[model samples]
Target: MAEPQAEVDPKTTEEMEVPSSDPPENDNDQDAETPKKEKDAKSFDLGDLVWAKMSSFPAWPGRIVKPWKNVKKPAGKKAVRFVFFFGTEDHAWVKEESLKHYEENKATLSKAGKGAKFTKAIDAIEEAIVKNQASKSDMESNEQSVGTPAEGQTTSPYHPPSDDDDDDDDIFLKSISKPTKDYSREPMAGKKKLNSSQSASSPGSSPRKGSNSSSPFTKINTPLASPKKRGRPFKTLEDGEVAKKPTPKKRPSTGASTAAPGKKARSDMSFLSLNLYNSFQAHLAQKGETAKKDIKPTEKKIGFIGLGLMGTGMAMNLIKAGHDVTVWNRTSEKCEEFVKAGASQAETVSDLVSSCDITFSMVSDSEAVRAIVFGENGVLDGISDGKAFVDMSTVDIGTVTGVAEAVQARDGRFLEAPVCGSVQPAMEGSLIIIAAGDKELFDECESCFQSMGKKAFYLTDTGNAARMKLVINMIIGSVMCSFAEGMALADKSGLSQSVLLDILNLGSIANPLISGKGKAILANKYPPAFPLKYQQKDLKLALAMSEQVDQPLPVSSAVNEQYKRAKNMGLGDKDTSAIYKSLTH
Candidate 1:
């Protein structure tokens, strides 16, 4: 069937009319309202100071002789070039288009600026003229005072102030009346450029024998200096040598005093202190930016050592979280599991540490942890001052403390984060991590641990995590042993294991471990939720720690002895629930 077409309304058609080809014809009126281009271009004045780009075309130490402008030119070209002259006979012609507006204002421009050499000369001439005028006025006053004498006599008999007069005028009169001597001594060492005119006037002047002009100090004996000398008056050595009078010491330049306090008073210590402060502030700002980026999508390079059963799953979670993960294991074959899940493999501990920014180790026991941490090719060899190392193994408190000290000595950060729960929790990414280290390092690496665990608790010291892990596993061992004894007693009383488990589940005796692993134990299933050997190690460490702290743990010690018997019987390779077999036997 054909579709029906709707008719367009007249008002809607007019609203959608096509635009005209030509623009609106009020362009002249708009231009008249707008300001002229010349007026805009004349913003800069003759003496206005501006900053130009420090570039090769204008050269270094260059200045603009003219300001920016817009000049009409031939149709083909749209710009007029301005002249800029640099020192050392260097100059360039730059287009007005190439120049930008100067940042400084007219008041800032110096009269003795780059091309204004005449400014200094003009100032000197004006100063000399003022000095001459003052001297002429003083001389005219003196002549008038001397010519008009006392009017007591018909013919005035008067005299100028005599040098021998004991009056108030003696100071000025005596200094001028004293006749200067013409004493001239030999020019001493390092006086190579004695003025010829001065030496010629003093015919009695003679050289001091064997004194060379090349030495730094010169010794000369003279009374009056020749007015024709060009250079400054430098002192000459020799007692009674009335050499050329010394020039007054120059005050610091006015330009130096005009500078800001920060610029004026500078020392090596101040400069270094300021530099250090600036560097620290810059680093903090960079870290803040990095933290913001981390909250978004970030690629972290993670190292996973000891790719055992738990390590494999934890490494997999990190990979799923889109981290760059590298794995290492003593057995070497264990890394293949994570390698299949897109992880890079490290042949040795050093390889892992050297490649990653943060390293995670989950080895077997205290000894295994030590081997990986302090061996020749250990993580210490790869760890650097800025790198962080995390040990997730259940070990003795002493071992953790020792490893932490070693890492600290090397200027590396250390975090002991032993986990609770076994292989199942590890696989599900639900392990509980207890961490201890520097607070900043703990906070920085918490997210990486979160990838493998449900939550992490930061403690105070490196030994805290190790002690906590031992305490938790001691409870697990005691509880598992109790359940084993109860089950054995029930079996001997002719009650079915299923009925006993069901009854236990209904009562307060039931717990997650008892319900979950007890069912498996009742069915004779021991797939190693927690390995028996590791459980035994944790029990041993806890017993020793308890003894040291003067705390009693009779049940944990008994459970540890049973684990010792099980280990001796070669059941150490079995799951922790195999403790029941040891108890029943």
Candidate 2:
């Protein structure tokens, strides 16, 4: 060490100081430093975006307004607080622990281009507030000097006079006394006096002060400038009087009123008058004497066949829409109710098809639909070019395709429109109609569809609508079976059936069908809104169609077996929810 050591510089040795054996401590310095460190640890800067919580509200995005402290608190218990602003006018004072920096990944500081603009504007406003406060204080201090009155003036309107009894009495007398001269009686020098009768008749009439004669209240003998007339000028006689009657020059009829000569008809009239005029024209039309241009052509005649549960409501809606509807049913009695509701009764299906521009059929099954279309005196026999046939029945794809081909072969248009709702939706005009084949025919029948359904979807191929219906029905059947199985399992587990339904309603699988059917199943009441047998038929058709395309539907096949079991148990006429009863019993 001695060999390695080099000579130390005197200036470097003087810079180094030796430590004291016992360091002198100042409590004031240590205490002040501790507080500063704590305050710096808890402080947040202005304009910093943070997440803050209010007393009862959830944590929301906010920005720190300022560092605040409760001065009234005891010294040691006192802690720094933050003033936070949520939006333009909402602010809260919260603890330091209640606020944190906003995570950038979770949320941005603010919307784009808005944060910077808001901060700059807020800073300007705060500066203006400080300046205004200072100006207010200065003005208040100068108020006493500015408010002092000048010599020979009173601060208030009223001033107490010198102590003089005579002066006070004179002021009082003058304030109470009326004027000596009456202005109403005094007339201006140039104005003429109005007659007593004229003055008495015109309550507000008075002479003009300085004019020669012109006054709205003055009665002058001078003739007035005539008013500018609108529209055509009236013909006058040689004596400058209006003519009693106009010359008979022919005027073209314009379906408007004509005023007599020298008289103007009012332009404003109530809507009742217009409605009555329209009614009179309609009456003339019915008599075949109205103007050709004013007459409305008759509505197209619409025909409805197979007035079953669904078809009856559909036909009624068409009649309600003001179509000239003709309805036919196999039972013949079913048409009576519709006939009473403004629909004409047809003795045969052929008569209905022949008379109507468009004919709609909604039968039970493929067999019934085939009989109604291809049988003698059926739709095929009556259809001609320009005629349209729409089948609203749910049937197999092959059946609908066959009917569509037969219809087109006879020079008639065909549309396969199977609806996806039950009797209630049909009655309410809220059915979902799936239509395919003949785009022009679909467009032509759109108005009729609107009257009977909520929405109509047009598929391009003939069999697509039938396929869609089958697929939807298959899903509906599967869902109902699953609902039933869940209900059975819940019951076996001794859980409340109603609570299970409520829980399901709160979850993802909740739907209108499930809610309605679950309630019905719980009550052990299955009325036939949709019969079980129909659901079974749709499932069978769906399975058969799936096999044709080599696609397997295991879930649908299982649901179909459950529906079959329910049907075999004599619940076929009950609602589709009856499958729940099969599992329970």
Candidate 3:
């Protein structure tokens, strides 16, 4: 039996309260300390490529980039780079310790890193890096041509000395070079220092990107300050040549990215969602409507795939909650009921994803998940900038990560949302949603989740939801098997089985699983609510997960065999309480 979950019924979604925070920089930077920096003393130069490690993922081939959506200084002040991973459409301010030369993990730079599909990203990043370098060279040449400007004529903004010249800012992380500058707290030359407005519109000044670009802003959770605060304030000359000045005398630009304020751009997952949200709010403001804090956001087009026992109930709840739902299933017949119930039907998964803003998929296993998502005209084909994909199926970490990468690589948001409940809870909109990935998407889908679940928690990362779901179901499967066996023993001892159930239900052992399944067992009818086969499947997956960490699970191991035994006895399709029949037979 499971422990009682929290009944979180706050008036508004938690996202409304927090508005979401910075990405997991501190968490990922734990291993990026001084010791690791000391271990690898080699310095990286601009356009220098390396293999950057992120989370537990395979080290991806990344280029040392001076321009990214958010170029924050890396940890330990290591000679690190904000690496833009070529094939994966991901970027990280990786520590020098967490990176190695590209030749380490990869053999050679083919057009394809993993496969031909990734060739586009590889070519794209390479072109961007080259273009950036070429642009810098051009700027430098122009600066040399211009020489010094007359006192009043602004030749260009100041350019800082090269990375080798400055130990105080060794990383040369000017997008955030040598991050210790502490832009907001630190002052620039007492009172004569320019503010954010001056940097944005000042004569010959270069603009900085988002303050959110700095993990420091995220750490402090403050609104963006002027980019001049982060990097040196540079002014564009009439001839477009930038000059250099001594540090502490006047700040100098790193000449990393040409982009300045109002042109702040990011090409990651947050790029689309954040821009969309800001645009929506801007529209409301332009119309003189109440601010977003008070205004209810427009609902997203909802999509659901799989119309099995659990999927059906969940989809029906979404419709009943007045969502504009479009549905798809492997079996076409199952979609008819939903179509008749004010829901629209999609001809294929691609069509479903194409038409919807957020698509929810719940399949039996990882293989089925792959077949739909990776199949022709599947999710990969349909994913675009404005759409999000939430897979609520019970799956392993590998499958979840694969789907997440594929979707994000294409600029589509993905969340692993394996639910914890069966048919009854699904129909009642009382399932517990364990979701991870795309915090922005989670915030946007508040109403849809509220309609489909009793409570939904936004856990961290992409694979954690699957892990949590597996562990929960593992316990449920083991307990149900134990319950089934105990009932069989009561009957064999010639004791009253009904009385035994009453005692257990009345005592500490009582939970929805035992109490509900116990009644069905007593009635001798095991209609498939939570199928025995699926229960066994969850246990099997849990066992596999345990093996990865080298943890022993003797109890779950034994329980899994019992489930297999029951399945062999043709009780696979029946409700889990039918495991009693396995004991009896």
Candidate 4:
């Protein structure tokens, strides 16, 4: 299929040699690479903001430029548009259906995008587009000055449809002797030009100060790019660079690589080797892409709900690890801290859920979790296919299962990942994550889990992780209560509470909870880490679960009463270690 000519402004410096959009053909040529969608089909013209995707490649940002006509195509194939890729300075012919509207794919593209490559691609493409528009305005002014074209030539034959298109990475290369633009940071001007007589290793190897020289691997006889093979590759030259001519060699009897009598054969001499295209692929991949951003695709577009002490620390860890974190809180002011720390603020749970790939919520009790996930403008309101919702709140198994079922019913995924360890561990990125439900979603969250926690266990069932979380918190409450009792008893006996803490923390039974909370008790500073009420709530939930399972917990039963006494004493809002105050009061 031959491509048609494109109209130009003749004012912009950057010339985009692209093809115009072809008319939709009545053929069954749509491959698995792109599915046919009559509803999405719309007309498009030159210079539109469209996304283009090719077979087996990630989507790339590009715009339609002027078309070079008469490019023949295979029979029974769909029409294609010439797409000039953003930063790579590459071009390709893309199918009409393969294009998506930029707005339609913006969030998905942003999630797919990262690194210097994606950023620079979009930035440079946008700059070019702005300049192109400015140049168009200039051309219109000139047209008025010079009198218009013949009356019939006023409207372009290829007028763009609606503001819509698609995206992909179907990049193809056309060989040229020189690059129109240099991709490197340094300007490709004013460098020493090498002569044919210069030897590769004749002079001394040490470089002079302040000299910028490329590595030998990057400096080859041909250009630092992959060009299509006709017979041999086309010669390309960088600024101040030379393409050396290879001396002809006689054919070998075994048909091995060709080499001049006294010269080493460059691996390139064997273009017909078994892995020729594979080698080109590897080289092109390195040449085209810059390094990745700290946040890879797996960890992009993370939504965090709740900004309480534990949520604050965990969400901060995600941000610090370079994930794109969007946070929402009941109190808008609480989100400001996260916003200042390079996180986006979502106004509602639905907004966060709809915009983000995976939303993780860590809030107060079951009521709070239920309220945020089920109320007006809540998580369910934004539930869509492929969205993931993970509740890290300390809710009971019944609550977890209910949320999970509701999410899955609405075509969204759900996971229960209740964490162990309090504010200190959360802030330090060492919380233990107990995860279950939707194994695939759990796997997708691996990078995020690693960022906010030291260890993560996949318990493989919806309520299993919540049960584990309850068990862990119940033990935490019981142990802390026991520790408080011991410290209070030691103080009364004059055995030195500090000494008791040191000995207990160093013994086989020593733990961070005992050591840290013991210090808090000694200082008589009852700031909340794991608040007494939440601990008591966890105990209360555990007892309820025990009742469901028909189990007896005499020690936990007694411990729950102690926490209740503390709660009634107005110590519920204080740290779990505040249980010591019940005995003293």
lDDT string for model 2 (238-272, tens) is 22222233211112111022223543221111111
Q: What tens digits encode model 1's per-residue C-alpha lDDT throughout 1-585?
A: 000001111111111111122232221221222246743564432221233222221211223332111111112233322222211111123333444443332234223243222242233224333533554566587774423212211110111111122331221111211111100000111112221111100111122223331111111111111111211111222212222322111112211332245432111011111111222222333334111123221355778886544565566567656677887654332343344445666656776787777889876677667777777677788888877898888778899899999888889889998887664445445577889987887877756766676678988877988888778888888888888888888888898887888888789875567666566566554544466776787788899999898999887888889999988755664567778888765
Worst 10 residues of 2 by lDDT: 179-188
| Cα shift from native, residue 260, model 4 (Å) | 79
Each prediction's TM-score versus the true structure:
0.49, 0.49, 0.50, 0.50
lDDT of each: 0.49, 0.53, 0.54, 0.55
| Candidate 1 Cα outliers beyond 4 Å, as residue runs | 1-298
Cα displacement (Å) at residue 444, model 4: 0.5
Candidate 4: lDDT over CA atoms? 0.55
Per-prediction RMSD in angstroms? 43.9, 40.9, 28.7, 29.2
Candidate achieving higher TM-score, 1 or 3: 3
> Per-residue alpha-carbon lDDT of model 3 for 467-585, expressed as tens digits?
88888888888888888888888999998888998899789977666666777677555645567787888789899999999999999999999999999866665667778888885
Question: How does candidate 2 score on lDDT?
Answer: 0.53
Distance from true location, Cα of 501 in model 2, Å: 1.0
Any runs in candidate 3 off by more than 4 Å, and if so which?
A: 1-298
Q: Mind giving the per-residue lDDT tens digits that candidate 4 earns over 425-534?
A: 55445677889999988889988888776678999978999887788778877888887888888889979887887788679986556666676677565545466777
